[model samples]
Target chain A: MKLSIKTIIPIIVILTACTDDIINNDASPSNIFRSFWEIMDERYVFFEEKGVNWDSIYFDYQPVFDTVRSNSAMIKAFDSILSHINDKHLSIVSNDGHYAGMFLNDTLHYSISFGKVYSTYDFSNLQTYSHLHLAQLPEGISYIRILPGLKKINVNDLNIRQYDYSNGLIIDLRDCTGGYMSGYNFCSIFLQDERVVFYKQTKAGKGHNDFSGLIPLKIKGENIIKKETPLIVLINRNTYSMGNGIASILKENTNAFLIGETTGGGGGSVMSVLLPAGWSLTFTQSKHYNLARKLIENGINPDIENIPLIDFWKEEHLDTGKDPQIEIAISILQTTK
Target chain B: MKITLFLILIYLGGSTLLVAQEEETKSRGTLHNFRFGIGPIAYKNYYSIPNGLAGGSMSFTYQMEKEHKTKKRDFLLRANFDYSYLENSKVLTTSEPLFRRFKIRLGPGLLWPLNLKNNQLHLQAGGNISFYGEYIYPTESGGKHIYHPIPYGNWSINCNALIVARYQAGRITIEESLKVAIFTAGFFPEFQYTPTSIDNSYYWDFLKINTISTIPNYRMIENKIAIYFPLANNQTAISWRISYNHYNFENSQKYIEHNLGVGIRF
Candidate 1:
């Protein structure tokens, strides 16, 4: 059949003329308020963990949402509800761009504490790369500090097996905060043996407690870390989210000894949403558990809870009576190897 | 609201079409013939869920036929893309969360004409790079939709091939050319290649595969049945076509939809 372009052109024009968006972008104030609350009502996984009365919340927030004449007011209403939830990942979305950050403020000096650890090695002389800090101590302990919000590191880049440590290696995750825990499994240098790393559960229904059967997440051991090579992983209260996830995994999968205080437990994997006001919100969609089946949503305790002294911040660890975590780690490694 | 507007638009377009504009006749065997058309349809649609959810569907197609006067079959190249989506334009929350399934195919095939008694029939077998995806989103009334940092959104993709057959004919008896008209129907089977676990989160590092990434034995099946009538003068520029589609992707997702559309056959 011979079809003419002259006839087809008009058909194409008429057909393509509709400017309707495939996904309806409805931005009405009431829709925004209702959708935001409904999305949270059905999607947030931490409701059971938090113990808040969701019904009362809706009743409380519905009135607030009713008063929202502008995006800023909408953001404020969202902030009021999210603040009560007190979850690390729960973020309310808006189309107009204001977020929870504009309201929530923290006074903790985690950065200063992190700086204290950096001073252990000459800040200027430390070998640095993407999200990684590797410094070989004269005591033969290879010092590696992973920063917050970093992704998986390539094994080839680390060449972890090539490092000759007479006193083993120290993976200092003092305040490491972000990224995926499963992502860092590429650093297989730490996997000691075949082990059940963790478990993950995703939401399946509208019920707040509704969840799918546990998906057994595992990591098999493969490597050449000699028995004589000792490993010491350090953690503190600020070691949260992915950092805590890393700590819990190492505690279960590796022979690495943990020193320092407990980790900051924030084990919920995140899910995101966008509001009619144009703000992007995120919150925990699933719960993660360690092999022991503990919701690492709370911090995990270290093997040896050696608290680093305040004076340890004044100078390097070599200063006796200071830096008890490092001193204990080195002594433990010396005796073990 | 948007759906009512769309229906009105479809009705307007259907009413404005020049059904009697073109005359129906056998092709003169032009080595290359180009065509394009659009239409509205109604179909049962489901993504990730078991039961079919009914919805308004749309289909678009563009094709070209190549053959010589002496050839028994024509080399046919065609691209077809269709979608079935469910939404409540008025109550965004009660909306079925935009359960959408998209089927697209483009490639070349051989269309062989069958010289039956007073009938013009064609058998088509083609190898197309077919891509099918059923996206499941969590949405609610009032236009509430889940967005970025989405921990749980399913994107099932299947890439495969298919076969089709259609019959179109002119007035067979000289007595009544318009009493009863011939319609066209086609059936196609697709072998799907899909992945089981692809954590396609926007936050992941792409260059390196995440350790948890698992590729399991995944299978998908798709079959389509279509019937179209040449409403005016045998040139189906105006026709009522109904298409039935059954798509199964692994055990987690399956869809069956019956679509009735008015299309302009080029």
Candidate 2:
């Protein structure tokens, strides 16, 4: 049979070039193990800094996974291995609706109340928006309480410009769960000129600790808070991820004094992968550091650690009078005003 | 040096074969092959979209091939278009007919035949301007999607290369379709889409909040084994095909689909 030119040319090209690695769609235990091991092996960027000998991890866990039969068991097994590395961004959620999100949050907990603090501040005028609470407290002071899991709260809508005349601004991030670091750079406005708030080093090459040149992260925008307003940022143990990113920026650039407990450090972003066993797992691939280039996985600290002892307050049978942290913030603002 | 000599020998051998095939090349005629077919598609996802069996799936394809006799070898021009849809079921989508994906590919290819015994082994490789869109249908559970009528779409170029081993013994016709690089970039947007958050009221409103990374980055492998049943005319025949589609996207998307479809080829 005479062959056509269309058939002959493509055949030679394909035959000349050898194809590598066929797509693996198998959902068996072996395939699942291989996918997990290989994906982490190739993509996990913090292997060196994390100090986990991944090769040994694979060798030790590879055999163990062969014995595991169920998705839940495999998820737990993978979690056990990943737990060796300390990264808040790492998480795993099984297809059966089992989430490993809470497992990775480091053992640090804190709670605060906007209602309690509001009564303590005794603001003359107060306003509430979607995710914002603003108070025009007496003595030329503007107190803004921002809560966690914030949605698209526009800074322009915040009427932050109105506070240009105010003597001080309080950005309360207490008890807030972290979110994306995209919106509301109201604190950056206080910084007059360009300022390097942090430094970012990404894994550019394959080797352990093979990082890119330390790139300075400037307070991203212009002086949004044009006035050099004496700002007080309230933070506690729960301030996390994007909140931490914001707190780090404010600490480095603004005159804002962070008064509360330390933050929950989740500096890196979350990246996820799916296993052949119909399970999804997430882990942090990059490492983020403060402008000082210090690993921020360890949360940022407050300028003045006036964290009120909850136990002391409980023993005294007092609500607001014994809360040292709130009193300290009010005293400082009062003096500044 | 040895490899260079080996390549030289191949060149000389090809030259001799061309000289010997001058008469046969002159005798070959212009050939045309055309095919139109339709089948069903199944949808599944564990990444951006909810995963489960779809309500229904439909697929259609039309291809035209031309072989113009040339001096060096036979030159070929091929163009084909494929469209497929996988309807959303309530279990995965929350809303009845939650969403559906429509993909269309239009491409022209160059075919290379590489056998002397009936020359049954053929390979075709070419690029296609691909258009893929997943439209979210409105159902209860709130505000309409931000992308309203425009299905979240990613238009990109794709390279498709396939091997066809056609064996015709008297009346029996067999073909094995080994296709590599069959447009695996569906889940990946052509550009970086600003990440959004997910809320209950407006579900697929790409303009808002996001709790997870639903963007799919795919690596796929496709294989089909088809047999054609001959009719009275030799050119027209009915084909029974069983194809396997392996979809691997990021870590959240992995599913294998075994498809069975019947169509006529001319």
Worst 10 residues of 2 chain B by lDDT: B141-150
TM-score of each: 0.62, 0.59
Runs of candidate 1 exceeding 4 Å displacement:
A1-30, A101-109, A113-116, A122-125, A192-194, A220-228, A306-337, B1-24, B28-131, B134-266
DockQ of 1: 0.11
Off-target runs (Cα >4 Å) in candidate 2 are: A1-34, A68-79, A101-108, A123-132, A151-153, A162-165, A184-199, A205-207, A210-222, A310-323, B1-266
Q: What is the TM-score of chain B alone in each candidate?
A: 0.47, 0.54
- Candidate 1 accuracy as TM-score: 0.62
lDDT of 1 by residue, A1-337 (tens): 2232245336334433421212224556666667666667766778888887888888888777666687777777777777777776676655433466311332123332444445654333366767777776645667777787566556457655445577788888886765665455644566656556787776666678767777666665456455446789988767777778888877777677899887767786664544433445576767788888879886789889976554454444434224557667767776766
Q: How close is candidate 2 to the true structure, as a TM-score?
A: 0.59
Please tell me which predicted candidate would have the highest DockQ against the true structure. 1
